[model samples]
Target chain A: MSGVTGQGPRTDLLAAVEQVRALAAKHAEETDEAARFPVAVLDELRTTGLLGLLVPAEYGGLGGGLDELLDITMELGRADMSVAMIFSMHCQQVAGVVHHAGPRLAGELLPLVAAGRMYLASVTTEAGKGGHLLTATAGLTAEDDGLDIDRFAPIVTGGEYADGFLITMRSPEARSAGDVSLVYAHRDQLTITPSGDWNPLGMRASHSTALRLTGRIPEHQVVGEHGQFRTVVLNTFGPLAHLGWAASWLGTASGALSRVLRLLRSPDGRKGANLDSELLMTRLSRSRQRLETVHALMRHTAEVVTRVRAEGDDLSRPRYQMLINSLKITASEECHRAVEDLIDAVGLRHGYLKGSPTGLERALRDLRSAALNYSNDRLHLADGKLALLDAEVRFA
Target chain B: MDARFTELLTPYLPYLGDRELTADTPLREYGLDSMQAIELMLSVEDTYGVELPDEQLTEETFSTAGKLWDALSGQLGGQGSDTAPAADAV
Candidate 1:
């Protein structure tokens, strides 16, 4: 698909992203300090027509794909990780609707997104299920003409600001937790009450707070077939989420590295003993290598996803599952490690100070959340089980 | 009904200890999760030398021992044989 105005999608999207980046960069410090959402950045995204990024061109969107998603997210991550994460998550839900929504629902929602009038939020996390996206403790109740949903999400990132939500819940006739469905509801269709405050060590601008949601949705609003949300999770949501987050973390690490490089090239750095120390140079080099490794792996996984989608192949295959899960695990860990290495290379004053000109302090705190975002330990456990069945590792 | 099938599946279903592995037993009740189901599918394929097609990969197919056995039998029978290869022979 071409750009919104017939220009190249990549170029047009990146140009708009550059504008958002400047705004996010400008407000990132205050956003983090105040523990608030970056309203200005989001406004820029809407005005630039980037909110409709993943919707198809026929629906008045740019019709961009996974590759474009990675580029936009990486750029945003460089400016502010919270902005990057919010945008990435929005795209994840858009992809879900675009790929799995029934024709009528698609026709209804995609144009609003394409017109940059909507921002979608994810509602997968339940109170007790920590990072488990495939199952739900809340079950939909059958009503006269639709299903009644009363779910308490433990953490809904950007929930208050979202124009709509894609929620996961047990089907009305579900016999087990795995019998799940993905449902969509506009903000006006539901009563969303904030239940708790969100004050975190990092990524504070995301406003991931507990929320109580009550609503009624028609059966037609279900994204896929009843009790078949597993297919949607494994196919679209899983891969795109992992890739988008990995790219965001990669951009965060690279942003810190850029700060470090700037310091090294300054006249004061040249006059001081810092530039001459091989140890410092070596540490920076190691960080660079790690970041580069993450970038390469993330790009490769995105390409694989694009290829699989293009070929009409199933992405839930064990090999692809392993690949996607492994990317999240590796990128989260490596990006954090790269940031830590840079912190040590730059020394205590610049790296440890809260308001240091280097800005590594904020980057460090933001990148720290990467490992705990979805919890790498949980993913490793899942991958460990999958590794037993998928013994052969084929690389093409 | 096959001893090899029982042997291959038993390890993953420790929750089903000492119970007779019947055709109608609900696999999920015996702690068969999505990942475990996939692992079980792979083992069945490796042991029986038959690939379960993508169309057959569904929650219903792995909902019970009977359904899973039927899927495996279908694949094995499609290879022009009613009898599975001997457990001890392979």
Candidate 2:
């Protein structure tokens, strides 16, 4: 069930990512204002060959691994977080398919991804489930040609616009919520209902609306072995999503600091009567330092994930889980602080604006999602268990 | 360890490739690092329904396929014989 990776070279893959980032930057403001999904950015990603970043090359993809995907994701995050996040969700879904799904399922979906025709969204997280990702409130029943999927996934990140979903649901034969399966459901096969409006303070363009879905999942589309979604989530989707979100926050920090850097270099900043150039420079350096820390954490975690995939090793280990959780907590908090420092350096006139000509206010709001999206509280509790049990765990 | 258990684990060691994986082959030769070693350990627990003690997670227990099999055999209350040949190993 294991396969090789890195069929594409890094430089070529990053070139495609840079193009997507340009498009994302162009549409970022409007996407945030309208709180709408970035349709144009998605189209640009597909055209640039970045949408297939995680699919293996044999299936017509770039054949890039998790490390390669992280490079693209972080760069995208730096340009437009909404686009990065939307793409991150797609990447997580791709990770699930590539690493865990049966060959027939991968054969069916990887081609569409390679051709830039489809995006896979993770349809997990129910209303009452809270942060319990493994438990499924909805259930799947076996039908004639496939299984009937009936569930109301409350927060599907790219659900409104995604072509398909990597959905979590309980099997008909399962005894409890612990016995769950992840199934693939195309948008055409599902009746989707928009249950909630997306109007978040930050990452407003993610279009993470609540969705009610009814569909049929064919036998081949049932990703991973039965009751193995926990393994899939712990080893594949969890790390990708956490690191991707960290990259987005780091990008937000980078974008905010870039604006401040521009301000520092302008005539008003350099030779103006009321400016303290040295103090501003100090703050700028501090902000950059924090961003660098976040980047280092993201890079190290990405390398481990890529190595595990390359070796075809099991991902569900106590140590790996500890790393993913800690990355999310530290990166989120540090990014928020970095963006705040940038705002302080820029001051009121430039910092208070919602959109560009210096977008500190918007950056702060967008970066705020890092701590709230997965709630560092939950991650801390998870890490607490590892801290007690594992005395000599290393981050790298 | 049950010979069937060693057969189940052989595939997890990516370096085996098309080569025959015998119990005597050193686990380290198959590129099993500490992380992969832990991964194999967890899978063994899951597959065989036996919880390996923390003390048994050392490099000595995982030096070779035969050593791992012997550890699991002890943990499983002697389900598998340790002194069998390659053919009888399974």
Candidate 3:
């Protein structure tokens, strides 16, 4: 909430990485280019226990927080955003589902996620919902036992991979679209048909396709309380998204920077007057500052989540909403700048190549869609400013 | 003054104490997982009131008690009165 402090979640950053790197090497470009999923790599990640990186150890997970999540996500993103996006939602589902569902259900689900027995995903996108449920016709009516739901959530990450879907629907209890409810739809219960190919310019393998929900969501499947979904899933999950996605931008930026430095100092690459030189440093310096602050925002956001975990009732709602929104905005802007700067500095040598620099291009496209997620609207940007000025935005 | 951290350093394989650490005494190599490192830094920062930069995670910075004392002293800027550090005017 307000004044986020603490070291957030702890994780064995290197220990978690040993296997990811191995599978990542063979995570071929052909699969990504063809808009095919990295099935083997995904399977490998699940087995590696990294699929549950966000789940706390108490819930049979590694108990990692934002920092470790970023470290792993960045490295994977540099290698493949397709993997990063897939993993991002996985962690996102862990963070949100666990947070909203409370410890008991979380304890049950997190262990399953950590053990890689079952993966989790967010069913929040919609062709009608502006990819963010901003404007949507999806509604949830009260069922005999639980909340029965029907919605078109487009662009779901881990959609094709996860065994369960955390879909968002407007509850009759809440009285409005913003008053959302989270229902955990098991893959067995709903129809998750892919709408089309995930043939984006970048992040070709994210494969965030459309899922058409067409059946009963039992009471046990409801992740959060009737009206708690919007603030929790939409507003709160923003920071988690920022932490995971921002790391992707950071990885690409750092990777590109390292590549330039290595080649520029070498005998063959030294003569360039292009981006491998003095003027690039100025842009890089500013970009670095922006990135560093974004990192701080990410840390701050995680601190809030951790605090909320420890002192559940003591959490501040409005502050959490604002900074969470801020982090999302900062993530979109800074990541865009990071990728743009990298392309400017490197001039797309391996990037635009027919078969080379697959990872870099994937990052570029996946990041382009960043501003589209979770209310990255100009109206919200204006609302974020007004939110700060008003100093009190009520949580539904 | 906290000898616990100093003692913790000894069991971490071994170290060749030059300006930086060697394979035997490599501080960077001493299983300083990012998670543990953050906790370690926080403990040190709260106990000693010095913020460690990501840049300062070099082998040289954590070579030995003596070199660590120098870096810590520089960062402390004389706020800490742990005077074993007082003799080293670094």
Candidate 4:
């Protein structure tokens, strides 16, 4: 379900996006399999230099800022949300390890990323039969080169293909009261047992299976301070990734709207053409308004995150926190909404009659993957409290 | 800066954007959001190995270039003090 990317000549970034679309379009079907990974697509990413998305220019990366990654991610999401998710996970890895682990560690790790010699997946979330922890809640031991992770993390994309898993560890190191540590484990040491299947409604190709992190973490691979890992997660990657993914969601939903509109304007080749012609314009108008609202929210959040990164104190401001929560909730909900409307606009005839259009089923699968893991009710309540609070509303 | 802080400021300046900040200007006037403020504090704490209380974030104490130097001088004054870095305000 890929669409044409950029024709704009202003930045090489547009070209980069076109490349992602080409790769995702090529693997749309194969990656849609519940158990299969887009290894080929990732190989293409390695060559495309998108893996070093967060790496600094001095380290031979594209050196694009946070916004660049967001734009590119949107294009990827449009092609296939599963691939976009993988890109997001990998970019988060790049931001965490390269930015915090000191110059020496970054010097060593940056080269591997720039060359596409290795791929990294996030093994932070875990799976439990009764209940699952939101993040890694286990511990690891200091080994010769890495931390020996004991439990497996669920929701890992690129697990089967990555050279390492950016696993979070827990310990009572007196350096900080919190019990979280950050470490990387080389791929060779662990086993990649499938959790179950990624038969999710959207992002079906995500392959976000559980990863058994029963392995060793060589000293060389242990990047970032285990002591201050939480700080890095909350303060650094938290807002940045939040805005980036939201922007991507906006772009994908926009693309879905565009695709549906294109179909509507086309000649009535189908016998049930009256179904689309009647209500298509009305729904299209609604989608446009929704998309615009998402766009405005993104603009607000991006500015706030930029200020929060450069300035500080703004995070506590009622405006910024509310915008942050609102962005997450709105983009996620609307993206899924756009997909539902788009599919219906295409009508049951497309699925039940016309087969499919450009992996439309895959698009639906990818969209729902993003829709989960969201609790708008809690978000809105917290946002309301923050808005009404007397004191500044900051976690710190 | 004691010759060391210069290195830190050099790398951090780009993060500050185009607004040319001076020691006298109120940091709030520019775009000193709390995340950046906290990030700056963390960087300072990591580099100096001195933890400051969270209250110092208010009161607009260290954010000003002038206040920052004053705070540093007070914290690092004379003989090495062992108490936690004093927090002024939020």
* Model 4 Cα lDDT, one tens digit per residue, B1-90: 334443444444444465545556444333343445556666766776665544444334544555654555455542212333333211
Q: Where does candidate 2 stray beyond 4 Å?
A: A1-9, A271-278, A393-396, B1-90
Looking at model 3, give its docking quality level. incorrect
The fraction of correct interface contacts reproduced by each prediction comes to 0.06, 0.00, 0.00, 0.00
TM-score of each: 0.88, 0.80, 0.69, 0.72
Where does candidate 1 chain B have its weakest 10-residue lDDT segment? B79-88
Query: Who is ahead in DockQ, 2 or 3?
Result: 2
Q: Compute the lDDT of residue A260 as modeled in candidate 3.
A: 47
Tens-place lDDT digits, model 1, residues A1-396: 332221223765667888899999899999999999887788888889898888999999988888788878888898899999999999999999999999999999999998878989999999787678777899999899999989999888899899999999998887668778999999988999998778899998998898889999888999998877878978899998999899889888888889778877889766643677899989999999999888888878987888888897777666788899989999998998998898899888778888766688888889888888889898888777756545454442
lDDT per residue for candidate 3 within A160-271, as digits (tens), equals 8778888777666543345567778778877656676566666667677777777786575667766566446443466577667666656555554555456656675556
* Separate clash counts for every candidate: 0, 1, 8, 27
Q: Residue by residue across A1-396, what tens digits does model 4's lDDT show?
A: 121223221266667668777888778766665456777778878887878767788888777666666667777777766677778768878888766776776777788887787688776665552222223456666665546668766667667778877776664232221345677766777765666655655565667666676866555555565544555655555565566667667666766666555555567534445644658656666767777887777766766676677765535444555677778788888776766766666667552232355344555555554545445665676566545432444532
Report residue A8 deviation for candidate 2 (angstroms). 14
* Tens-digit lDDT string for candidate 2 (A100-186): 988888888999998899888888788787867777778889878989988887788878888988888886676556567999998
What is the per-residue lDDT of model 2 for residues B1-90, given as tens digits with 9 covering 90 to 100?
Answer: 345676778866666678776768666545564456667877877877877764454445766787787777667665444554333322
Error of 2 at B69 (Å): 14
**What does DockQ give for each predicted structure?**
0.19, 0.04, 0.01, 0.03
List the candidate 3 regions with Cα displacement exceeding 4 Å.
Answer: A1-13, A102-104, A131-136, A141-147, A172-174, A234-236, A271-277, A283-287, A304-319, A348-362, A385-396, B1-90
